[model samples]
Target: MQRLYARARRAWDRPLTAYYLVLGGSLLLTALGLVMVFSASQIEALQSGLPSTYFFQKQLVAAALGALLMLAASRMPVKLHRACAYPLLAASVFLLCLVQVPGIGHAVNGNQNWIQLGGPFQLQPSEFAKLGLVLWGADLLARKGEKRLLTQWKHMLVPLVPVAFMLLGLIMLGGDMGTAIILTAILFGLLWLLGAPTRLFATTLAVAATLGFLLIKSSPNRMARLGCLGATDPGPEDQCWQAVHGIYALASGGWFGSGLGASVEKWGQLPEPHTDFIFAVTGEELGLAGTLSVLALFAALGYAGIRVAGRTEDPFVRYAAGGVTTWITAQAVVNIGAVLGLLPIAGVPLPLFSYGGSALLPTMFAIGLLIAFARSDPAARAALDMRQPVFGRMRAGVRRKTMRRRAERPPSGER
Candidate 1:
């Protein structure tokens, strides 16, 4: 057992481990999410007079586009990414502001945070705002750190906190408390990575908590969501209808589950089965084993992200990776916690596991950011360089064989 443990540690310490974990874990979660979305959404789509595969098809297309974006991001240099920070933030802020305009902005499920984009499609700028904040905030802190200005409390909180608040205020203006909470998490995450003083951190946390409490209290809907925590019975008007149904779906799947596409709750009982409560549907269809597997995949991805952040020499890489990790981790925890009745329903989709194109696209790009950082490590870069020739030789051999076969073969028309 000791030898086994030692071997595992050595393998984990390899230069390429973080890269492989991010790549493999993200792919698996996305693929599984596609499968679950197809399963969970069929009934809802059919009831809406659309094809059973409608949602799945849209998600598939988004995944394809996201893959291209991921590929492009992974190949970009650190300097290039840093250069893109301000532009991306500007675009995010612009789109987010656009969502507030009448006739242009749209609402879904009571959240006015979308812009209609022609037939059967919409844009959620808040999702991209999360990515923008990660990159922009990282760059901001990295610059300050280089100048040794972070030691002062004012410098630490000045522009970063204010910009984050501006974004949060915009998000909250659309009544998207869930997204605002996530943005707040990303801000604190950046500050934490910078090693802010304990008193400052605590004071900031208290202020955020007070504001959050006020926000939640002012909205009856938000209050109702909070009241549903650990609820065993659906409240008045079935206020906990979605929450209760989610629990029932999870409970019905004892160990292995009812099998994929066989969930009863998704047939109209549970709300947002393909978006918010998809984890419950996953439990109902794939069982506890499937749920645990999903959790493990997220854990692996989060761990790999932390490793990339911790092992990096560049302050930008460290802060950006840490911020991304915090965003995804916080969103996932809030989402999964709501499904399990451990916390209030925040209406945030699970990272990479929920069926929203807006959410998936930015997340995949963030995963690619981690991949880029992992590859930037000196040891990992060297390892990759050593393997390039092997791949090149394999490609060369394949081309030669293909050409030889072509020369020896008869024309297709003759055949």
Candidate 2:
């Protein structure tokens, strides 16, 4: 057993290990999400007089688009990503503001965070804002390090806190406490990664807690959800119905599960089975084994991301990887915790496993950014080139194409 463990550790120490781990874990989660979405949505689709595959088909389409974006992002140069940081941030802020337009912004479940594109199509600016904030914060902090300015708490918080408040203010204006919470988590993670002073963090934490309390207290819906926390019996209160049913869904699945497409709660009892509560659907259909597998995959992804952050020499890579890791891992914790009744239902989607296009696209793209960072590692790049000779050939082919194009062009003004 000791030898086996040693061998495994040695293998994991390889350069491309993090890359493969992230790729494998992401693919697995996406595949599981597709299956679970189908299982959880079939009953609801039929009840709505639509084809049983309706929701599943939509999810599959979104996954396909996300995959394409992921691929493109992975191949992009790291500098390009950094260069686009401010622009992405600006666009996110603009979109968030646009979602407040009375005629353009669409409300669903009391959250006016969606901008209508067309019938049955809406874009959630908050989702993309998470990515923008990650990129922008990472770049900003990395720049601070270049000037030796990260030592002081003031330098660290200067633009970050104010900008974070701006984003949070916009999200709150739209009544999306869930997205706001996740955004706050991202900012906290970035600051922590930047090594903010202990006193600063303590003060920030207290203020954050106070603000969180105020936000929740201000919302009757939020308060009602919180009231379900220690309920012995939910007793048919609409607020607790979803929470109670989520627990029931998980309970119904014992060791192995009720089997795919066999969840009773998804048939009618559980709400948002395909979205915020997909984890419960996963448990109900695939059981304890499935949920554990999902957990393991997320754990692997988190480990790989942290490894990239630690091993990289680039400050930007370190900051970006750390921020992205925190965002996804923290979001997953919020999601799974709510499903398991360990935390208040925050209405946050499971990172890659939830059935929402807005969340999935940026998430997959973020994974791609991680891949780009992993590839930036010299050893990883060497390993990839060695493993895939076609990449070298493609580089050569591109050079040849450029040379040929130059040669084919008419001389000076001869054309």
Candidate 3:
């Protein structure tokens, strides 16, 4: 017990508060996600003539790989990452463009967004695009700060918003409103962190929101889904297949779940028992208790990510860390909320838990970046090694002068 306490104290002496929070939260969430994926995917898997552990097995592999990536990323030198930021960002953009090509890009659902690389591995350019933009934005913003220029904020939107829109346009062209929405959110968050003028942000946001609304309203499929949103009672099984089923699963679980592996909903009642709507499987199989547990896990992640942002001294670390957290946690909240019929039905995946290769890889790398910053912060180091600097000669000079003055002084009582 004493050893544990001492070790924990040593850990706290560093700026790793956020690092631990984000990394630990990510691991916890991944574990929980794996279990839920199995619970949720069983029915869908069975229906598709696959094994019960199919999704779980894949997710588990992804998690293991992600863990290694996280560690490698955390241990990587900060300068290397900074140096590679631009090129990585550019490559991600290029990939995003490639995914838009006819032969290269694979269509899923209605979105021609994924680039399938044979062997069950599908790459989503938008996923990499998100990370690239975050890294690129961080580097750009930091350089602006280094130059000690405030006016750069005005010109900042020029390249940034266009690049963001280009990514958004390409994603939208692929019919991925969810990815576009997420990209928009990330961009706005980055801009906010960059200290863009408030009035400009407000004006730009209104215009973009207006455009987003028009796009959604114009799409029949999106409009149909939007119609089901904000409903007091959803019928995902009827008009809203996913939502109604999710509600059923939640209601079935009641309190202490039907017990793990006891979910009937995974049998086929839920369209995507393991993927986007896995939360429903959790609610049905684990009940309200299970659902709450999952919620608590995410809450912990959000808190930890925020802690990391707060602990960092550099704006780049702070922005990148917090931005990644926002991308993941915010998306989770939106996904779960939409599933439970609390919000509109948008096809956003729950991070780390969702069965997508593209999302998992980038998310893992982002967590790695968070860990990297957390592991090597100078502020954290200074706090841990609180030894004052030694100035031997200067110290001797001051001490000798004090002694001489004292010796030369007349007795205090003489006056």
Model 3, 1-415: lDDT tens digits are 9999999987755465655666777887788888777767766777778897887788888788888877888777767777877888788778878887888999988888889788777788888888888877777777777877647655677677887888788788888888788888888888776767888889889988998999988998888788786554545446676677777787788888898989887777777777778788778777887778778777767776667677767877877877887787778888899878887767778888777656787898888987777666776556445533445666888999999999999998995
Best by TM-score: 1
Candidate 2 regions exceeding 4 Å error are 230-232, 389-415
Model 2 agreement with the true structure over 1-415: per-residue lDDT tens digits? 9999999989989999999888899999999899999988998899999899988998899999999998998999989999989999999999999999999999988899999999767799999999999999999999989999988878889999999989999999989988888999999888888888888988887888899999999889899888888454666656688888899999989999999988899878898999999999899888999999999999999999999999999999999999899989999999999888888888899998988899999999999999899998999989887968787788999999999999999999896
lDDT of 1 by residue, 270-385 (tens): 99999999999999999999999999999998999999999999999999999999999999999999999999999999999899999999999999999999999999999999
Task: Give the candidate order by descending TM-score.
Answer: 1, 2, 3
Whole-model Cα lDDT per candidate? 0.95, 0.91, 0.78
- Candidate RMSDs in Å, in order, are 1.8, 6.9, 13.3
lDDT: which is higher, 2 or 3?
A: 2
What lDDT is reached at residue 275 by model 2?
94
Find the candidate with the highest lDDT and give its number.
1
lDDT rank order? 1, 2, 3
**Poorest lDDT segment (10 consecutive residues) of candidate 3:** 383-392
